[model samples]
Target chain A: MKKILIITFACLISIGSFAQGNVITKHFADYQQDQSFTKVNVSSKMFSLFTEIDGEDETEKAVLDAMSKLKGVKAVVSDSGTDGAKFYREALSRVQKDGSYEELMSIQDKEEEIMFMVRNDGDIIAELFMIIRGADDFVLMTLYGEIDLNQIAKISRILKISGLEEFGKLGGN
Target chain B: MSSRFLIYLFLISSFSGFAQTKLIKTLKEEDKIESSYHLYPSTLRMINLQNDPAFDELIRPVKKLSFSILKPDVYTSKDMHTAYQELLNEGYEEYIEVVNDSASMFVVGNESKSRTCILVNNDEEYYIADLEGMINVLKLGEVYESIANQDTSKIGLGTVFNYVMGENNEKRERAKRRKEREKNGEKEAKKESFQVTIGEEDNEKKDTTSEQVDSLNAIEEKKENE
Candidate 1:
């Protein structure tokens, strides 16, 4: 009877882990068709092409190197007129419920709240997810597959992705 | 029976291609919409004129391009939303989207071969572009920025507008005057007699024409007074 109980508990834990794969991806899909929200998905194929480019400068070389390891990037942004706080709270709760990601840092100011979370593969970071809720905007961006915090911020600046400059604070540059 | 089947297959394939761009077609059919289409060769020639190698290389892969601009007063956000839904129904894969209270833009592609980008801004303007063949969409911003930064004085905007509007009245008038001069064998004499710079010659001609207009007006006023 004791053995059976232990086996059942182990099976339940495995099932729960399997179900909690990626909250951001699932949430992105839900809003892809929503007219009020903006979405961006860059496939690995696009990133693979970046690896072949010969950088003309040091900054370009660093950005290219960081981009090579990325599998994909997905983002969902809400319009300024909408209630950004609601989406931020909902995403925060979902991340907490998943129980797999560890919170790296968080900032709360008078105008905005930002949270950075990561799911690690041993010592290396596998995914870096960021949630930002401003007075007039809400942004959810996820960069998965072998992330380097230092270089990731540079990629956002080079790409001119609107809400991603916040990552610069993490890189301490 | 096989021949009939082949005919039907060909007809279906041709129509499916049109169906893919049905949204653009519908918008084009609307009244008061401004649209333009350009093939690769003409577009390449135009880009070459810019003399920027980076900008030229970026657009080499594009086979064809077409765009339409719509006014927000005629097409509301709700209408744009419906059009977006129709694009999804037509099997376009969403690539990028940016939406805010005042404006929204989205890019969708089909199998990496064709791309459609749509931007709608409330109470302002709306634009759509359909491009064939693959180009790095991310580098587009950089290319445009480089072009925008180029020296504007060298572009000769007045001549470009005249060319686009198909109004070359000044050129035709000058050609006619030159032909008449050549026929009278006065071209060489006139060229030898004119030693002034081009700028000074234009100013001299303008001064003479304005003086003639003022004399004619003075004569008309004196006649009325008499």
Candidate 2:
């Protein structure tokens, strides 16, 4: 169990360099997406996520899988520990108005440890959801955030990818 | 009521009229919902729950997973006809399922109209090289809620469990469980399963329903495993 968390944590070493400026007009010409930055250097893949927490004690891989498929990502890494003590801090902040809360039975089937790293095209997007579950404990954490979509546009322009501009304008129009 | 008054009324009517509504004109949306979604079935049992015949047909051809690397599951059955018939009801009128072997996969939702899909795989054994490798299945402008909210009701979400159980030679376990149940004279009631999401607002009620629904097979299955 410890080994899994360690490996997942190591993979999450890239998610935090998203603190800056880059904007580009929509590109639909070359079907270009991920037009944000020319180069991406993530700091802490897990910490950079804008996360939400729901209060409950359940454990499973479904939650992890759900977070992995979120967009604006190119990769992800997950691992965790059994630290139910951590839940109090996150749930206070993670609950949302969308009724987006996913629940679990309890910390019963606890194999609790999770970590993830992710990006889109090439920029760090979200590194969400991690927990540590023991036979009687669980810790849940999540992150969500918007990447520099504008930078994605600029990168597409620089690369001169066609159709990206058109795709971008699909909504901006 | 004279011609002059009629002209005045016509002018007023023309001035007061609102722009005619057009299908394309109104849907010209700026804040468009990307409508992206992803699904990660627990395991291969999900195939049985498929309720879509075409999805089953897609699975039928795949006898084995030859190799791994850049692998993804794509269901090519244009016509979904299966015992579980849920896809037809949930708007998967035409779709595909991409199986990246036993551990992972990529699916495109409603291939006919909007592209969407769900993915599932093992993180510890296979996801060694790339951490976010599993997410390659997601497309732009997708929402998980929209797809799963509609699909899981009919087929059931035990696909993941089925997958895990399946990997461990679960058919053997299930058969054994069935025998044990027969020895004990246990009969499964209400063969026609229905998923009724009774309450969303009240937590207690939902919990109560969840508890009541844990049937004997489930209870026995847990005890036998232990």
Candidate 3:
């Protein structure tokens, strides 16, 4: 009876932890298991490389400065082959129930919608989660560690990376 | 007057009048278009944005906000880039420009004063915003980010215009009130009332400066370690 009770308690603890897993880890695992999703993981060390990317513009230097503070970034994109709508809905619900995040903004057009959420420690944003659900595409991106949208926007501008400038509207002092 | 001078004046006046008439006609047509929207400070303040903290500072200092959502394919990528180049040629200083796979954002501002203009175009639609007053160029990203977060269909461009105007009005009113109180010889009263507020602002500025310093130090340390 005692052995059974201990095992049951351990199981409950594990389940609870799983339910409250790190936002990126929970979704990233799903991306890995599903062949339909494209997962892109850029570790902290790799983020530093953004600083060295050649660009004559001053914004390039700003991007390097911003990338230096970044810890990690993970993105999961669903193509036409995947049930993107289903993944979008599930991810949205999961983030909604997750206590660690605060919904910052949401925009929708026709059948497409995008949501921005963040986990901040005081003024410092630790994580930024973006969910984009379109008619044919769905994307989930989570950026970790002192994430500053201004710097990210500058980086995007310098690198000619489309759609990243939208993150700059995330709000800062 | 000489016959030649009379003839020149007649031709110049006629052409000027013709050009003015054409300009007036174009302005009237634009005003009649239902697709366009205009918002003032009073109308903007009335919009309830659910008091979202993200917009707390983003909307301030905006004297006006106006945008028109154009249909897809109306302006090709080449056309957009050409227009940006024209603005540059016209001596509009480039503030910040971002060209990505999906869309592009271009900003231009005056050398002196706070007047700014932003143009964002994608495959589907294009938008233009004219903002007055002091606006931090860096914070424009946050403004765009906030816009990206909203339900464009539900909120429409009107909401953003109104919100910005409303915040601008609020700032104006506060400044007006302060000016009036000062004129009434209530300097001591004003000092007492704004003591805490001024202290808080000072502290906030100090905190921001310190954080930037620390971040710079961290970057230097990382470079050394590398």
Displacement of the residue B214 alpha carbon in candidate 1, Å: 71
Fnat (0 to 1) per candidate: 0.25, 0.00, 0.00
lDDT tens string, model 3, A1-173?
99999999999988974564347686557665565565555445445433433433576456667766877666667665556678788888888786779988888779778788988767887788888887888888777777776676555443322234446556431
- For residues B18-57, what per-residue lDDT tens digits would candidate 1 score against the true structure? 1127787777677525534343535544735556565455
lDDT: which is higher, 1 or 3? Answer: 1
CAPRI docking class of candidate 2: incorrect
Off by over 4 Å in 2: A1-76, A82-148, A151-173, B1-143, B148-151, B154-170, B174-226
lDDT of 1: 0.62
Candidates by TM-score, descending order: 1, 3, 2
Better of 1 and 2 by DockQ: 1
TM-score of chain B of each: 0.52, 0.19, 0.43
Per-residue C-alpha lDDT of model 2 across residues B67-157, encoded as one tens digit per residue: 1111112211211122114433444322212121223322212323222222223321211010111111111112122223343323433
Q: Which ten residues in a row have the lowest lDDT in candidate 2 chain A?
A: A22-31
TM-scores for all candidates? Answer: 0.52, 0.18, 0.36
Q: Candidate 2, residues A71-151: lDDT per residue as tens digits?
A: 332211111232344543333233322132323212223344332222233454433322333333432322234433333
DockQ result, candidate 3: 0.01
